[model samples]
Target chain A: MGKRLEGDGRGGVEQDLLRHDCSIGEILKQRGVSRRDFLRFCSAMTAAMALPASFAPRVAQALDQVKRPTLVWLEMQSCTGDTEALLRSANPTVAEIVLEILSVDYHETIMAAAGHQAEGALDKAIADFKGNYICVIEGSISTKDGGIYGTTGGKTHLERARQVCGGALATIAVGTCAAYGGIAAASPNPTGAVGVMEAVPGTTVINLPGCPVNADNLTATIVHYLVFGKIPALDSHGRPLFAYGKRIHDNCERRPHFDAGQYVEQWGDDGHRKGFCLYKMGCKGPATFHNCPSQRYNEKTSWPIAAGHPCAGCSEPHFWDTMSPMYKRLPNVPGFGIEQTADKIGLGLVVGAGAAFAVHGALNALRRDKEPNEDTREG
Target chain B: MSNQPKFKRYIWELPVRWCHWVNMACIVILSVSGFFIGNPVSFGSSASDFTMGWIRFIHFTAAYLFAVSVMSRVIWSFIGNKYSSWREFFPLMTDAGRKKTVRMLRYYLLIDKEVPETVGHNPLATAAYVVLFGIYSVMILTGFALYAQHAPQGSMHKALGFMYVLFSDQGMRLAHHISMWFIFGFVINHIYSAWLMDIKEHGGEISSMFSGYKFTVKKEE
Candidate 1:
């Protein structure tokens, strides 16, 4: 599969898909993915895909029959944490089930080769998969310093991104950095960093923005593309609508506490022990937009806020800059800035006093300003 | 005086009267629209965009009108009659009125068996109106502050963002909600006192607001 596409990886990309779909029965039988396990995964993928339970069989047929789409996985300026987390996928490890079960033409981290051999393999993989393959980009693109700050195989990250996007069916920016420019693009962004969609103009990029987005989101996105030939519904940020549509505050388990005005007033207070709202403590969940509290991390084990810490809102764009204090409310509204409740109490007293004084003045004015015979009777 | 009819006209010029009633209508419209905007309901399906945009537009328009109307009333306060002008509130400006105010309050509470024929705005009555205006002024500022949120880069936006940053959008949101209660409280006291004044002191006190006539004692002792 590697040497045959020697020059054009597009052919190799097609063949990879062909083999994944054509030999799945034989291969699953051989690899022991098991017919029942494969069907279960299909139904689960369908559910994840947001289709009815009845679509499970169709999903099974599609999963078992769809050719493995060619995928080009690139790492730019990142910790490569997405790849590391990908290894933790609970179901069949999409990396293994799809990435391996198919003829993955190019994947830097998992590939056996390195240096000239690996570089040569990447080129072959691209040419073989052109126009039909999927491009999964991890890490942000550094546009600063002539994109020299981050490079892959002598090509700037931005350049490689453009090159791969030109002949791709879909581009998936796999983590916060690659999706929404993550922390790298936070205020005073030193790197002039950008997400894949920003780096490659006009390319339809789907973002999976979390420090490490839930792996199922990644696999589900792929399965969606494979089965439907189109990306799923997305929100304003081009993240899947199902995942990024609601405020973490809205869906948080702590929300009842918030609505009830019960809050964790101090770090070690009894309220904190009782798992009250973190809003007063500067939780940015109310302002942030994400599905963290809903989908959760590590298969619903626990999310950051659930662990009794305020949400850092890592998935939101420039969150570190905009939603700081991470737990406090947005700074005072503009004109209302100089005073809070103090203004209320202070002004109330002032006006209340002033009203008292004016009432007295009115009485004097009533006498002095009155006509000569008007008020003598009252006196 | 004519034998058949001679109408009394002591205070409240036509424009002042006009501004007062107009201010009332505009406030009602603003409060109604503003309330809906504050708690918008996107009646559309889950996929549809929110629909409170029209409600907000109406609210903002009403706020702008309310501001103009309020400014007109403030100018009127300065130049209108003894009953309606700044003089009306002048009694609240000194400490000497403490006993008078208590007496006036007692009169208002129906504590005294005999009612005073308060010809002009009474001490307590004048004070309450001033407080109402003060509350309205703060509500106006808050109204503008809330308006500014939708256009953070526009003038209103910058203004609103300024307040949101200063107090926090949540605080502003809260101020906006809580002030409604103050208005409600003011209304409760205002109507009750007005009704009481009409009942005890003068049968035509409130009607004088519309008819611009108040009857003084025919012949004081």
Candidate 2:
């Protein structure tokens, strides 16, 4: 496998170690993660999925007993941000154990294989698992000029995605890039990047869209698939409803301040110090739908809003275009230069109409005065 | 003046007038509150004051009324008199209607001194109302789509969630915001046109909306 993956001896050893036959319980036992800790993680996942506390044991049972499912991670035109988010999770042991539970047959970034070996692994994984494997895509697929922009192992991303994702039982688009093309498909998008669903149409794509998607949601999605044998319910955007069903504003910690009309007028103001609502600072919480307020990030430490910064609406579709002017309340009207907002355009049109009507009315009045003889007495 | 007697004809039904007035009030409240919701005014000093809460309450209440008014108006278009018929909204659909619309356009453009006479809404005003109704439909859809976000599991959410297929949340908000100005533009032109028609036609044009009657010249019977 190209002289084995160099660095951190663990990668080489992990690659050699195969756990295709092991159940998640066996993996947890081997990892020395206690039953209590595993159960706690299960409960947390159940809660995250909005399942009742009673379902925690059922979730634990399902996850513990389920054999490792084959997962093929395709990283295309990506920064590897999602992988980083998962690897740097707050509770590394639990994350590690979960990863161990899944037979990750092919992952370009972390796999020890290289060149032909990596390509071989991907093909073999697809053949072995066929329709049984889960495909997790990490970035947008470049389709410009037939995806010449992004290639791995001599195949275009579009070709790779269509081949791999087309056969998976269900595909999980793991980040905003893979889900909605994110920044890669922003305005003046030169690469013609599109999400996995667009690149590989008709595939069952469950979009988990965030800048670098919170790893807990990914873990929960995997766990839910393990327990339910099907993808969780999806919203209109094909996002898992548990995570993307509610606006950040509805569940925001600073909602009290918003209702009160208290706001952070500017950066580092007294109101800002007082933990006022960031809505006035152009927080996109009101429009964006994600479970960040409840789920938080980095092990429920703090999300952007909790840290006193506004939500940038990173999880939304085409967020780069739709939720920009990051410090403004409304998105800028796109066509007539950059700075004009909808309100400005709307107000301008209204005023223009009013002015036009005024001029028309005055003209009508002057004409009426000149035509007094034509007005006549109708009696 | 030609020797033709004038008679009062009942042009607008009660439901038509009610829907018109209700829609007008809702538009005003929805515009004011919707603007505030987008760019809220910071006034309350304490969390308990609930200033934005009250504003949102008013906005939602008006939105409900507006939706109901629009729905009832659509229903009334089927049941109301020929003057308020659904056919009036599509003036260009018929040859006579197209001719009247052209004549109205000619008068408005000062190509003709005579205003086109009609028992109900003139073809031009009917066409304008059709456009206004289109805007109203968009406003309702976008408005409820935004509202549906608050209760994701509610029936309203299920019903309106498809709007995301048409517009992103922020895009929907932008559309909803811009449409308010279109309505405002329509209102300005509408008022001016009504006033101009009232003065020029001397047919109780402004009073007809309130009284449901318009003075029409009696044709030989």
State each model's C-alpha RMSD to the native: 12.6, 3.6
Tens digits of per-residue lDDT for model 1 on A1-379?
Answer: 3321222244233444456455444555555566776776676566555578898887666666666666778888888889877766554433355444345567777665566776766676677767777888999999998888788888999889988887887889988899867788877888999899888989878888888877767877887876777888885568886676667877889876654546676798977888876766878776556777866776556788899998877776656555554545533323445334433543465556556555644543343121213352231
Q: Please, what are the lDDT tens digits per residue for candidate 2 over residues B1-221?
A: 32345788888999999999999999888888887888888887997889999999999999999999999999999999888899989989999788778877977886666555667787888888889999999999998888888998789888876787888778888888888888999999899999988887667899999999888665323
Docking class of 1: incorrect
lDDT of candidate 2 over A52-79, digit per residue (tens): 9999999989988898888889998889
* Leading candidate by DockQ: 2
Tens-digit lDDT string for candidate 1 (B1-221): 11222234465577667776877787788777765544333232322233444565677787788788878878878777656677667675667455567767755444543455466667787787788788777778767875543332456655455454454434555566566656655655566566655755443678877876655544322
Tell me the TM-score of candidate 2's A chain: 0.91
Which ranges of candidate 1 are over 4 A from the true structure? A1-26, A90-95, A101-103, A332-379, B1-221
Q: How accurate is candidate 1 locally (lDDT)?
A: 0.66
